[model samples]
Target: MILEVAILDVKPDLTEDFESTFKAASKIIASISGYISHDLHRCLETKNRYILLVRWQKLEDHTIGFRQSPEYQEWRSLLHHFYDSFPTVEHYESIILP
Candidate 1:
């Protein structure tokens, strides 16, 4: 599985609007192939700051399947405006230990 993470800094006064919009945008992402689940977390130290964590079956499921799909455009349109700056998204794989 792949874990996708993004740190989103919303416009100072738009956190409430951003949250509501995100609730709507969530459906678009969840509909994608290989999507396992996702979560949005708000920062206590910074009200406008948020973290998005998404689980996917594979990397391409997000990079190619979702980003390249028409649903992505809707996702962008719904939530992109709230960002103060474009967020950098990264993916990770779990490490196993003995």
Candidate 2:
């Protein structure tokens, strides 16, 4: 599995609106292929910052399947404007520890 992470820093005074909009945008992402699950976390120290973690079956499932789909446009429209600057997204794989 692959994990997609994004650190979103919302614009000042737009956090509430951003969160509400994200509720709708979440449905768009969850409908895509290979979308296992996701979580949204708000930062304690930085109220306008959020962390989004998504689990996918493969990197292409997010980088290609989602990013290239029409649903991505919807996701962008609903949430993109809220960001202070474009968020940087990265993918990672889990490492087992004993």
Clash count in backbone of candidate 2: 0
Count the clashes in each prediction. 0, 0
Per-residue lDDT value at 7 in model 2: 97
Each model's lDDT: 0.96, 0.95
Model 2: per-residue Cα lDDT over 1-98, one tens digit each:
99999999999799999999999889999999999999999999999999999999999999999999999998998899999999989999989845
Clashing residue pairs found in predicted model 1: none
What are the models' TM-scores? 0.97, 0.97
Show the lowest summed lDDT stretch of 10 residues, model 1: 89-98
Q: What's the CA error at residue 88 for candidate 2, in Å?
A: 1.3
Error of 2 at 20 (Å): 0.6
